[model samples]
Target: MSAKNAGSKPNKPADVIETGRLWQRPGFLIRRLNQIHISLFYESCKDFGITPVQYGVLTTLREHPNLDQTSLCAEVGVDRTTMADVLHRLEDRGLVKRKPSPTDGRIKIASITPRGLKVTEDMYEAMREAQIRFLSPLTPQDRATFVRMMLQLVEGNNQYGRTLLKHFD
Candidate 1:
């Protein structure tokens, strides 16, 4: 099917459809790319003892400091339970500081600690390398178009995700 027609439901009878054609599906390709990206991210970041999600949280907090936990969860595109667990781990490692919000006693505000900032800064090159490697197979023009299209897809279907991305910047 053409790219524009790919999203439509198949008109063919399921009994006669070939399952092997799954390889050509966009969802399959995206899932495979996610697997590759995770592998490459870990291979490059293994020395730092941080997972991809942890790094994302650290970087997000670094950019937008003192975000309440709920807001942080939205910004990081994760559920509240996951956010709490991540924050607990970061707080235990002293990579993040969390405290009760001044105005809202029940809310916890999170800030990246000095060590977290340093770690994020130090991991910048490795992260950049991992991203470069992920897109290494694509030509320069293809890479740009691929990224634009991916962003378009994400924005078009953002609400379908379990957690909606909330961008503050």
Candidate 2:
């Protein structure tokens, strides 16, 4: 021991070790990745002024056309309240139109407007670029593996999620 340190106690460890461990935790990493992707999406599609969920809703509406809000909720993997809010926002933006169902007066069927379709199409490249950027750090093979594993995890745990995903044939 050095002369100056002879009477001193050894230094205590930090209250919490800060480094790779937290970053490696699956929940933390997944949450962080989601945040990063959202940032990338916003950056790439800033001009469109639409969120990821909105884009998904618009795309689903474009495909299904005139789907009831409940159906949209299932297709978009969101709760009824969230779907309702999103629909209101899109309708205010004039990107979607909603009308009462003829058979069921209480239900509203939603359809993407021409403007919504155009916006969705225009935002395609940007969204694609954002996805590419998000996976850019991985090699081609690794990217495929990563995506496959992600799908597997999501599928396996789907039942536990708050949102329900509608499976497509």
Candidate 3:
């Protein structure tokens, strides 16, 4: 199948895409890029001792504090059970605290502790380094263009993204 017409399956042969074939495919390239980015992020962020998902949650909280578990899950693109588990871990580590929301006693509100903010801040440098490492091959001009295109694509297709993305952004 032509790369442009390829469905979810690997390029027809499954074994020979190295000839600049699958390299031109969006879905395949995007997945491969995500893998590279995640690998770089994890390898470079080990000292921060936080997973990528946790980092996303932490940064989102930094931007919008006092969000409830449901909101946090939506913001972080995690399912309820998984969010609950991660929240529990953060709470146990003293990085986050949850209490009954004043507006709704039945609902729990989550917030990053001062320590969590500090830890997140400490990780910022490593995050920048990881991002740079991931895109190191690009020229500065190309990097800017790539980021602009990516943001455009993301914002333009936000409605089609898994979890809608707004809950997190």
> What clash pairs does model 1 have?
none
Q: Residue 153, candidate 2: how far off, in angstroms? A: 1.2
Task: Encode model 3's per-residue lDDT on 42-158: one tens digit a residue.
Answer: 898998778888888888889899999888876876777888888888888888899999989999998999999999999999998999998899999999999988878877877
Q: Which stretches of candidate 3 lie over 4 Å from their true place?
A: 1-20, 167-169
Question: What lDDT does each candidate get?
Answer: 0.88, 0.89, 0.83
TM for every model, in the order presented, reads 0.86, 0.85, 0.78
lDDT of 1 by residue, 60-143 (tens): 999899999788878888889999999999899999999999998999899999999999999989988999999999999999
Candidate order, lDDT descending: 2, 1, 3
What is the Å distance of residue 4 in model 3 from its true position?
15
- After TM-score superposition, the amount by which residue 125's alpha carbon in candidate 3 deviates from its true location, in angstroms, is 0.8
Which residue runs of candidate 1 sit more than 4 Å off their true CA positions? Answer: 1-20
Question: What pairs collide in candidate 3?
Answer: 75-167, 75-168
- The superposed Cα distance between candidate 1 and the true structure at residue 48, in angstroms, equals 0.5
**Alpha carbon deviation, residue 165, candidate 1 (Å):** 0.8
